[model samples]
Target chain A: MELQFKSELTISESGFLFDHSTGLTYTLNSTGQFIFRKIQDKQNAMHILNFVMQEFDVSEETAHKDLDDFVRQLKEFDLVSR
Target chain B: MTEKKAYSKPTIIRHSVGVQNKFGRPPATVPINRLDGFEVSELAEKYGSPLFVLSVKALRDRYRDLKRAFSTRYPNFQIAYSYKTNYLKSVCSILKQEGAWAEVVSGFEYDIARNIEVPGNQIVFNGPYKSHEELTRAFNDGAIVNLDNYDEMQVVEKVASELGKTLEVGIRINMDLNDPPWHKFGFNVEAGHAFEAVKRAEAGGKLKVVGLHIHTGTYVDDVTIYSRAAQGLVNFYSYIQEQLGVKLKYWDLGGGYASHNTLHGAYLPAEQTCPTFDQYAEAICPILMSGPFQAQDAPKLFIEPGRAIIDEPFSLITSVVSQKRLPSGQRGVLLDSGMNIMSSVQWYRYNFQSAQDSGTMLEDTIVYGGLCMNIDVLQASSSIPPVRRGDLLVIPHVGAYNISQSWQFIYLRPAIIAIEDGEVYVIKKAETRDYVQGFEDVPGKFITN
Candidate 1:
């Protein structure tokens, strides 16, 4: 099954995201917002991880952990399916 | 090439108005940042916001000041910290290190004191209501139980008779000291209730009267009020000794000392409004010494000070969640903390500071908590500098009663960090969703496979 980014994701200019499906709103920093946007663009987990690694100056292990934690949060809120 | 680029450059616009300082010198620069040479914003970035920070130096200094004041005045003075103020293990451990005995009002607090290894004799059990089991445990542990009323006196006597042991007890007496009277707890002196309780205890011969306890009220500003209270207790002590031939071992002036937190309607801050420990000792020592009872026969002085010793050293460091302009042209700054956690805000005009220098003038503003409830306001109308979202706000003088009284309503309580020796250590970790749900029982019938 192909997973598509839900239109319920509302993003403000200041990197605040409000998911209508789940009534939780989160304020993310610029870098966090960038990663979230990339994930929402129907990119695979590996592709999103690579993009984050290329964009930010961080170790591959750290990037993987951060992305995994972010995805786990989305999964917990039912914002994305594994 | 035909169309020449016409560029409109970005320009800085400054708003100016002809204004004078109507309410005195322009409100002093509201320090909207940094505390104890540490950036609050940086701390919030590393640890989450709504953080509690304790300064070991401030705590030590306040303790030292109180110790120096009482130790110099009376030859035998013992300070028992009221554990109900802030019973966080870290706080209690610090006080224990400073040679403070534990003054507990409940069995739970007594257990905490024992857990921290506070000597049984050092624990003074006080309060109006105590269960039979709690009394028996306290008595067996050799705690000095301060009996409040005649019913408690009978209960203690009955328990002592049953165990065939004479329990060491004290009677809390309420005396009219020319100040506002505290009628809720303790026996009344003028009404002869205290004398009656003492007489009954002496006649029963099962309970030994070892001390006399009195607490006037909290946030008392006048030193003379303490002196008056001491005088009243002295008069009673003299009467009891002369009539009943029993000498009290200690006189407990119960906890009511005010910390340097600004009161709700005080014109000056608490630092200026409340009397220092030295001043309080000066007022009380003379009255204690001037009585007919000398040091050898006079009861040892006991003070159960809670708020004054602990309030100034701790603070709540919260992040500014959002900022908005009210329809009435007032500014509102929302923070990550609320009255649920910072309960003292309901009675105190909490001082808020920024972590760093913003160099902005003060304006009338209201601060709100993260809760959606309108009643969760931290400050009603405060003169503060213009703040933007993400600015760090520091609420000082929150060490007393905040943690003990904090409730878990909406969001989880944040981590409490104790800053000692220029390093930050998490004394209490923030609560998580799993921690909150750990107590609930999910039955198999309610679960779907």
Candidate 2:
């Protein structure tokens, strides 16, 4: 089965996420939700990681590590593809 | 055959001052899990984010504490749950089960009290504006109707005369405290308005004066203020008895009790600043229990305490939507809940805590609600533990006013759940698209997209 990113993902201000394409919903923590929003802008992993680091006080190294793990989970759930 | 592994990645570790205590090193790790014994994450998952969870245990405990304080101090006293605080059926029902009579300000609240089966005489009708219909309903039900002004008195008299039934009424007397004065919602005693209202009710013959009611002001932490108020009421009561030969059956000190929730500009936490119920009783009960007052028929003491009773039991569980850095390097947390549900956000400095003990340092951040409005800020410059998207944030002491005063704007309000005996029951269902559209009228032309 081919997996493609769909614009059907709706992010609510309260951190609720729903993917109409898959009929599945997910909730993000404050940080996870922030990264998902950044990813929606179609930025590269490094650019997203940099954005997270600048916005949050987290170090670039920590941001990159957290972002990589988050991307892996998103891929596993078929929410995003490389 | 051996399966090939994925590419190796570096693990970035974040550091923060862990939950530490005095005497050096991190304190004994007290796990932040279930609040009041209800699992935080499980509640969020089941009820959906931005839900309101009320703890029956907290409500019962606070109610018992307040009741015991007055009942022990004063010989005769009755507590009426101020319905305006939170009229959620489940909340009111629990309070009714706890033996609290309903005290309502408007006809709507009166109807709710009636619907809940709180006896007619048990309901105290308060507030400045009472229509003829409302007065007739309350009078017919034998509810204690508190007259706010002379205009309302004439209306009551007219209604009672028309019905040919004498209705028991009370006059809300406003007295001048030491510095600040209560201007709205009562007849001023010093200005002779209260005396006039009392005289009119007595002469009407259709209205019987049975009670005297007064609510000094909101957020009153000083017991001395209430003592002064009680002294004023007692003096007024004595005057009425001596001049008009009328004895009241009850004296109502209206609701304004301060809950343990901190105020926006307070120097100390509310728990430390607010006077306990015992303190309040110690002040007012003596005046009622005094020798001269006791010599005559001691009236039943009625206290309508709303916020102090319900504020601590409820928590707003909201999911963190996003985190961003402001231009000034301040962290801003956007959550799913906003001013729509938590109306008290305008005046209260809500205490937000993490659901799980994530080993992150505390940072000062501005918490924003899901609403698109610029005024949707929930907390401006609050210190919260390092939080991320998907983390559940628990806002405590939101039992009062939030639900009763919530507004429906952009999004549907979440469900209200009551957790009791380790069981979760939905008292109110979350709103959905269909629920919003159910009332919307759509023309056929608008259906084409």
Candidate 3:
């Protein structure tokens, strides 16, 4: 599945995410920030999983789970659209 | 190339108003690697995941401690182990070895006592329903069968006359002690049902009323309830003697003693709220001692202790099946054990600890069982540290009602091991598909199809 971040959202290198439309701020861990940046760069779930596995010492299953969890949370916050 | 740092799952925590502060206090967690000097990992590897471990020493000690607390205060006292709480043969055998009489509520429990070689005279039969055959058997075996209602009194009278025996029986009385009254099992004293039942039993020539039984309720933390119930039992005993001219031989104050397991939604832990065994003895024994009856005429005191002696002596160890972040930004952990085996989680906030140290950061997490149902949650919310798949979680104070109430659901039940003097042995074997299917017989037509 593909995801696009809302245009009004602003993200920082320090793992802070802000949504101008909703006035809501979300704090991300380093892994969440990495996945969020990948999603913003128009990367798909497979590419994000690969990137997470290569960037950290995690198995394919764990990286996939993390990517799925991150995308689900993004959808729940309305920070991204399908 | 340098090695990459260890990875934890990505988390996007919503920083919104009224959101629970994840970083409040340090995680109330400590690694529970060993229980009763046995390694939890070793036990799980040996028996299987989701195993129950019972301490034989704890069982004997709890029974002895409760017995000492009451027997020292009241001279003519007997502790009958309540079979319904946990009727594991090993557990019952240990209590029986400690001189505890069997307190059974059903024919199945009575059969278990008899199978364990507990003599009928040492058993006190108490329950709401007793079949005519069961009453005949109990009467023939010389068990102290307590009548729950008037119908039971008539059945007992019939059985006694048919066998040409003057059977000694007891009547269970329920009264409003201001605590939650258990009116379902016994005749209500406040409503005069208890007096009427006793009078009817006296009118029946074959049945003799020799004991008075009252079960206040289950998990009673307040000592004053027992004091009031004891006082009520004493008052009723005196009335029976004056009006009916029958001297009761025993008073069976049925079990409701609370263990040190925290009840769900309670402000304080059970350790802070529940009265100790000594405190309960003090509340009960004083009233029985202070009764107007002389030393020679004092009634024998019987307290059926189920949870108090059984709860703390057992622990359940389950392995983490998986972990994930829920839509609410909370951590969710799925365990190999479920509501099928851990049924008491509905009422208790059981003490759960990790079998190994995972991390120091505490997170808001919900513990789920492996069951497919939505109600299979073991813990709705717990502030625990990060746990990986296969990590063991130890749940203590689960000895009461869990085994007897648990059934074969989706997953087969696990084994239970007993540890004593550093030696561990299986009290119950893990269930297998064949064992579960052994009771079934496929029809010939279905097999042909």
Ranking by TM-score: 3, 2, 1
List candidate 2 segments past 4 Å from native: A1-62, A65-82, B1-31, B178-180, B443-449
Measured over all alpha carbons after superposition, the RMSD of each candidate to the real structure, in angstroms, is 12.6, 11.4, 4.1
Full-model lDDT for every candidate? 0.79, 0.80, 0.87
**Candidate 1 lDDT by residue in tens digits, B335-367:** 989888999987898877766554444555688
Instruction: Please write out the lDDT profile of model 3 over residues B147-239, one tens digit for every residue.
Output: 998888888888888998788989999999753557887789889999988898888788789999999889999899999999998888888
Which ten contiguous residues of candidate 1 chain B have the minimum total lDDT? B6-15
Q: By DockQ, highest first, what's the ranking?
A: 3, 2, 1
**Candidates 1 and 2: which is better by lDDT?**
2
- The best candidate by TM-score is 3
Cα lDDT of model 2 by residue, B167-208, tens digit: 788889888884657778778889998888889889978888
lDDT for each residue of candidate 2 in A8-53, tens digit (9 for 90 to 100): 6888896677778866776566677667777777777777766676
> Residue B378, candidate 2: how far off, in angstroms?
0.9
Candidate 3 CAPRI level: acceptable
Best by DockQ: 3
